[model samples]
Each structure stands twice: as C-alpha cells, then as structure tokens.
Target: MKRLLFALTIILALNVALAANVDLDQLDIAKFSLTTDEEKTINFEETEYIITTDSITPSEIKLFFSPNNLVITAKKEKPIEIDLNNDREVDFSLTYLTNLDAVTTIELKKTDLPEDEMDDESSPISDLNPKDQVNDILASIKANLKFLVYAVIVLIVLIIIVKSYKKRANPERLYSKAEALHKEAQEFHKDGDEETAQELYDKAEELREKARDMENSEV
Candidate 1:
C-alpha cells in the first residue's frame, strides 16, 4: 500500500509538471474596453468571470468568481497585473486609457510581455476558449482514473481477506487427513512395495503442506 501511494504521488507530480508547460500560442488573447457603469461576463467550460468598471472610479476593476472576488486599481500607461491561479504569473492585464487626471475608460487585455520576459517561477493561469475546454476534459479523466485505482485496491484487499478466512476455518481437518496419509505410507513401506510407498509418501507430504498453510494463514 505504501508503494502504491508513492507511485500515485509520482504520477500526480508528473501530470502537474506537464500541465504547467502550457503553450502561449494556444491561449486566446482577450481584448476589450469597459467604460464607467459597464459590465461584461465571460464563461468557459471550466471557469467563469464577471467584470465591471466602477462608476465612481473607472480605474477600479472588479472581477467576480466563485468563493472569491478580486478588485484592482488601474493606472495610465502601467498595466494592472493579474495572477488568477496565484502562480505569480501575469494572466490578464488592465490599464487606464485616458491622459486626464480623472479616470474614465479602461482596457482589458492579455499579458503583452514576451515569454522570455516573464519570471522563471511563473506559470500561466487557465483562461477561456479551446484551452479551457481541453483542461476541463483532462481534469475529468484524471478524477475518474483516481476513483478506479482506489476501487481496484479495495477489491484485491477484500479477496485476500476472504481467502485467508477460508484457510483459517478448518485447519484441524487438514492435519487429521495428513496424519492418515502418513500412516498409510508407512504401511506400504513395511510391505516391501518401494514404488507405491514413494508415491504415498509424496501424497502425505502434499497434505501436510496444506495443513501448515491453513495454520499459518492470517485474516
């Protein structure tokens, strides 16, 4: 069981590593504009997002997701950094579009930095479109495989317990049969029937082995 758990951990780690190596080209680049009092919602197979620009402070952007919410204040020229999966990588960016001191309009876009410019410790978050659908399918299959592994382990353990219980139930009966075979072999040997005596001895040994196994069986 310990070995099984170790193997499972290794497989999980490998899967995570592979998933982290996402292709930037496969991701859909998002670009949109939001004015004061404007709201937009985007839905994907795996995740959903609802965003709005504050009416009073247009630079303040609000993103809605399940169980959590994120709000950011954008600045002119400097893009607002977003790390949705908390991997320290920038997945989305927001920036103010006006030169005036008062905020008015904001633009939402994908991270524009080159892959080489990103931090070495960074990993991209799962965004929308074909990539999101693919991720959802892979996650579903991984969960199913985990369930199957646990089921098979349970079945094997149950079979072992049942077999051990059967062997332990009537060990005395096996020993009695083995003693009878041993006495019969001795009688044949005393009658000068060497070949028959040898065969009988072999049968006696087999019965004795069954008795020993039954006695040693653990449930």
Candidate 2:
C-alpha cells in the first residue's frame, strides 16, 4: 500500500511540474479572427477591415487565440478613450461600459500578443518614442477661421462689384439718359418749336439733378 501511494504521488507531482513549465522558447503563433454571415462585412479602409453588427440576427463576434496564455477584455464604448499603437501592447481601462448593444462597437481584443508578427526578427520601428510617433493636430477653431475669412472676403468683393455695376447701369447714367435727353432736346429745337424746346430743356435739367444725386449717394 505504501509503495503504490508513493508512485501515485510522484505521478501527480510530475503532472503539475509539466503544466507549470510549458516550453515557451519556441515561437507560438496566435490569431484573432471574426466572421459575419448576416450580410455585415468589415471594411477597415486601409487594408484592414471593421467588424460591424448591422442588420444581423444575433450580432456577435468570434475570437480565436493560440498558446492559451493571452488575455481578453471587452467593452461597449468605454468611458475613457484609448490611444493605441504607442506600444505594441494594449492598455484597457476597468471602467468600460459592460453593455454590448451600443452603437459603436465593443472591441474585445487580446493585449498579450507576440511582439514579432512573424517568426523572423524584424526592424526597430517599434522602439520609437510615443510622442515622436504621434502626430500634432490643428485646432478646429483655427481651421474654421481660415475657411470663414476666405468666404467673407469673397462675399465682400462680390458685393462691391455688384454695387459698382448697379451704379454704372442707372437710368440717369451718362450714355443711357443724359445723351438720350440731349438728342431729344435737339430734335425739338430743330422742329422750330421754341416753347416746347424750353420745357424739354427744363426736363433735361431735372434729369441732370437726378444724375448728380445718384453720384453723390454712391460717393
């Protein structure tokens, strides 16, 4: 009985040791995949794809990982925003919204992934500083101010041009009214109607006054 009990105890200890010391020296390839058949496809725009749950019956995503050592976390539009790609690893907040039915997707991803995408070692772009990697963005007000100023200048120039054209196209302008009145007065004088010509001359003088008034208003 003692010998049998000793053998069983040795077997259990070896089993525990084997589970504890997994061979991690070799490269373990792991993947995270999602497939949708409910007519919602993922198009991430830049060779990558987005997984949407629109018009689907169940609206669920599947994840597959390898090595069984990775960790998974999920949230529906977490309260705090994340700035990814600074490091190869992801940092998720514990305060994420637990509800999965939000409009924006709930990203459940594996943070502990292999640093080397391939089995072979690669370049040192991954060692860059987070600030150096990040790009500076302009303020919204500054951008809108540029567009607004351009629009206002264009509007003012158009108004000035339109007002100038209206001034030149008046009924009492040089060519349209004064010249016509002069011709009419000359015709009346040539017809030997002196009294009519005097009245027409007065009318022409009134038209001249109107022209002067229009010019003064413009200046």
Candidate 3:
C-alpha cells in the first residue's frame, strides 16, 4: 500500500509539472477561471480568475470569451504574486485591458524575460487552468482519503472480540476462520486466481452460515 501511494504521488507530481508548462507558442494551460462584471468592479484579494484566449501577440492579446470581450496588451506580463514563494511581497501585475472577470481562460505561451524579472515559483499557480488544477488537487485528496478508510477497517478489525467456545457457539472459531479466509482471498485475488479463492471463500462462508443456522435453530 505504501508503494502504491508513493507511485500515486509521483504520478500526481508529474502531471502537475506537465500541466504548468508555459509554451506560449503552442498555447496550452493547466486550468482557467472567470470573473463576473460584479467582480470586475471590485478589487479582490486572493481571488482567482479564469481567462481564455485563442491567440496572443506580443503587442496585444485578442480575447473571444463571455462576460467581457476586449483586446489587451500581451507585451507586458501579468503578475499576481502571493505568499506561495515565502517572499511576503506582491511583485507581479499585468498591464493589459483584459479583466479576469471577463475572460474564461488564459492561454499559456512561451516568453523570454530578463533574469531579474523571472520568478519560476508562480509558474505553477498562475499558468495552470483553474478547473484542471482543482481536479488534480481533488484526486490527490481522494488518494489520501483511502488511508482513512484503511484506518477505519483496521479499527473495526481490532475491535473484534472473541470470548466464546461452545463449538457451534464459539465466536473465536468464526473469527479465526474469517481471518484466514480474508488473508487467502486477498492473496488469491492479487494473483488473479479468483475462481479458486471464491470457492474457498464460499466454503468458509458455508461454515459461517451453518453457525448462523445453529444459533437461529437454538433460539
């Protein structure tokens, strides 16, 4: 299970990395979001926007989305710096007429920047399309949730008490048989030997069924 989790983590990391690529010429994005005219009028703090564009020229970027449609300069970069880099400073802004509230997505493109102005840390947060990033995070959250389910299964297994010994009335007998079957069934299932494991499971279940019948008959 640990190995599986490690593999999943690696895959998630790789996908995120690939999604954040800033190849502007080809124009792709990790995710996107939008802002309403209501939001456009207000200044937002820590609020995100999704933007979409078919093409981006150095002088101006043409947009064809909903809520707002306008051309904005692409020559300058839009910088919305946050605390993600531990810099504790706001150091980015885009000098374009394109309001995030009016745009559906931000098309990523390749660009050259001087060393002093380049910040790679914000690349992942800014470039990823909003929806895709949300999906990735949700998937990671789901993977983590599996551990909780495993923990609960363990708790229930641990709480199992076996304190009777009257042959057909013994709880220990039933639990022991069950544990043995569970282990074998899992191994067999992993090995893709479902038919044999199912047969064994059926036999173990038959024992349990007989015990249940015995208890019911006595009652």
Candidate 4:
C-alpha cells in the first residue's frame, strides 16, 4: 500500500512538471513584412501560431495565435496575457505591433509571478504604474475607435443595400456608385493589378451608362 501511494505521488508530480508552455523560440525571423494575402506559421513545443495580413485592408496586419486551442486576435501594441496550462495563472504574454507599412513586430515574455501571487497582484488596479495606466487608456481609446469605424462601415453598407432594393432608380445614386468604382479601379491600377483594375473600370463605365440613360429618360 505504501509503495503504491509513493508511485502515485511521483506520477502526479511528473504530470504537473510536464504541463505545456507555448514556445516562440522557433521563430527564425524577429520581424517581417507581409503583404495582403500572405501568411506565416510557426510550430514550437506542440503549439502552432499563425499571423497574416488583412485581406481586405492592405495596410493592416491581422494575427491569429493558438495556444492550447485558445484562439487569440492580436491588436497593435497590445500585450495579451495568456494562461497556457489552464491553471488560472498567467504563463506568458505576447505583444504584436504593426506599422502603417505592414511591418510587424512580435514580442514574447514569460511571467515570473507564481500562480497564487498572480491573483493578489491583479486584484488591485492601483498597483499598475503610470505607464501601464496610460497604455490601458490608449488601448481603451483604440478599441472604441475601432468599434466606431466598424459601425460607420456597417451603416454605409446598410444604406447601400436599402437603396439598391428600392423600386425607384436614382441617377445621382448610380453616378455616386460609378465614382466609387472609379476610385477603386484607380487604386488597383496604382498597385499594378491591371486585370482587376480593368474589371472595375468596366463596371464603372456600365454604371455611368445606366446613369446617363436614367437622366435622359427623366428629362
């Protein structure tokens, strides 16, 4: 009976000691630039992390990291605390910062605080230093700004959808859509994507012709 108990204790200790810590040391490059539609993945210590550029926006880089099957969306200059082992303690932190040029920087740091001490340290907001407070404020502001931008985009899309469903055809509406298409085509042309640019240009010309027909019919 004594021998069995001792062996059980050792097994439990080993299991606790072998709990996984997501590693980032396998990343060969510290910083890299990714264009839209480009992605990079790295595997380390049985965990995989992936980062990619935003497909819709060429200037933004979006990152997806999975540690212990927990997906994380990274934001610029934000440090995300992760609990890798699911012990309700922070194991490490990862910060992703991106530039306007689509260059990204990754930072990984291991937390030194013990599991129990972490709870005590986090219980008080007054413990944070001045710099941390400022960072928190800035992050809050950025989050609000992001939400507002998304809301505006959604509103614009809703307006366009509603206007399209209406029975009356407005020449001004068609002209505005043609103008928007022309702007998009110009961007694609500037990027040297001639095929996409030409497609958009053709669509803009079609819209312009429809607008002219509507105007002549009304007159």
The backbone clash count of each candidate, in order, is 0, 2, 19, 0
Q: Cα lDDT of all candidates, in order?
A: 0.54, 0.39, 0.45, 0.56
Candidate 1 local lDDT, 1-219, one digit each (tens) = 345555665675544432332122333333334444445543332454566554334334443433236666565556667765556777766555553343354444456556643332222333335866787456544534544565567556656766676665566766777788788888988998888888878887887787777667633
| TM-score per model over all chains | 0.31, 0.25, 0.24, 0.29
RMSD of each: 17.7, 27.1, 17.8, 23.6
How do the residues 96-201 of candidate 2 rate in per-residue lDDT, one tens digit apiece? Answer: 2222333222322222334443222232224335653331112222323444565556556656766786777575674357667677888989999878877777
| True-vs-predicted CA distance for residue 102, candidate 4, Å | 2.2
Q: Which candidate is the best by lDDT?
A: 4
Please give, for residues 1-59, the per-residue lDDT of candidate 3 as tens digits.
33544565566554443233222222212233223321211112233232345454444
Q: Alpha-carbon error at 163 in model 1, in Å?
A: 77
Reference-based lDDT, residue 93, model 3 = 33
List candidate 3 segments past 4 Å from native: 11-47, 56-175, 178-201, 205-219
The better candidate by lDDT, 3 or 4, is 4
Model 1's alpha-carbon lDDT is: 0.54
Question: What is the alpha-carbon lDDT of model 3 when measured against the actual structure?
Answer: 0.45
In terms of TM-score, which candidate is stronger, 1 or 3? 1
**Candidate 4 residue-wise lDDT, 135-215, digit = tens:** 655544443454456545655665565566543567788888989999999999999999999999999999999989877
Shift in Å, residue 59, candidate 2: 40
Candidate that would win on TM-score: 1
